[model samples]
Target: MSNPTELTHAPHRDDVGARMGMWLFLFTELLLFGGLFLVYAVYRHEYYSQFRVAALELNLSIGALNTVILLTSSLTVALSIGALQKGQKHLSVMLLLITDILALAFMVNKYFEWSTKIHHGIYPGSEHLLNLPDGQILFYGLYYIMTGLHALYIIIGLVFLTIVLGFVITGSVNKDSYVKLENAGLYWHLVDLIWIFLFPLFYLIQ
Candidate 1:
């Protein structure tokens, strides 16, 4: 019969496998977005002037605000993971809640930006966009597709973090077993990284 102390100290598989699997999934996501980036680069090169003109139609202030929001959210999620690792469950939950609020703020800003554009008759199939030059059309097309996809990822990350928050509250994720929160943090960071790229390409370019 095993001693009670020995039973408590029994070895189990580390979380390395779970982390590796998450990394692999993230690699696939990178490839998918990389292809889109390549396409954007090709078209931007072909229509440099038109692309610049099209980009100017976007709101720099709103884009920059959203960038800041996502970056801050990323930091919060990282802190949440750290807090969980340190056995600070209440702090971790509060951090996650802050992250969620930031994510919602981002979506709200995005909604207003898009709505303003649409109000001005600037959208995928609108006659205004259809009348623009081919390069301009391509620019707006890529802008919509890339930003929309990133927004979807943000929503997914928020949902995942919410679920992880529940797990933390229920004690499924704690100082000893918090890989779930770490994985959620990884996903949230990925979303922020994508926007980091998108921000400069779409908003900062002249």
Candidate 2:
């Protein structure tokens, strides 16, 4: 593949339908996350003390760090899309690389945070649980379910972006036809937005 800098042009899609489709999908994603937030709202209110303790036990710093990582990645991806729309090929590719590294940072932090929780017997079906009260168990259960589902979705979103980033890196996207990169950025922003709410609800609310 030629160096991205060698290509000075980029392609922008003029398709109204494509843009509309992306927006519609984003709306659907918002609804899905809204449902999860509703579930958290209901459960946390029901088990306030236990949930508070659970939240305190959570790695707030990790969540905060990941939040910044994802947010910065979103900016880079947005900038990449801008570069394409502006016909700047090299800038788009470099932005994509930056976004990927940010994504990697986010995922690595999640790994360390989850592993720490696992070591403390926080995972479901763990044989060495500390045997807390029923309310605490319920708190942990909700915490795991809500956060687990969110994290799973994040992983899937990252995989989709990895594919798009590869397209950029390999020159398939190049200086033209970068619609896929923009779409991928949209999805990544959705992932970041979900975490924004999750962080406040799970950590700050307590």
RMSD of each: 2.8, 6.0
Against the hidden true structure, what lDDT does model 1 obtain? 0.92
TM-score of 1: 0.95
Candidates in order, TM-scores: namely 0.95, 0.84
> Which parts of model 2 have CA positions greater than 4 angstroms off?
1-14, 127-130, 170-176
Worst 10 residues of 2 by lDDT: 5-14
The alpha-carbon lDDT assigned to residue 108 of candidate 2 equals 85
Q: What is the C-alpha lDDT of each candidate?
A: 0.92, 0.78
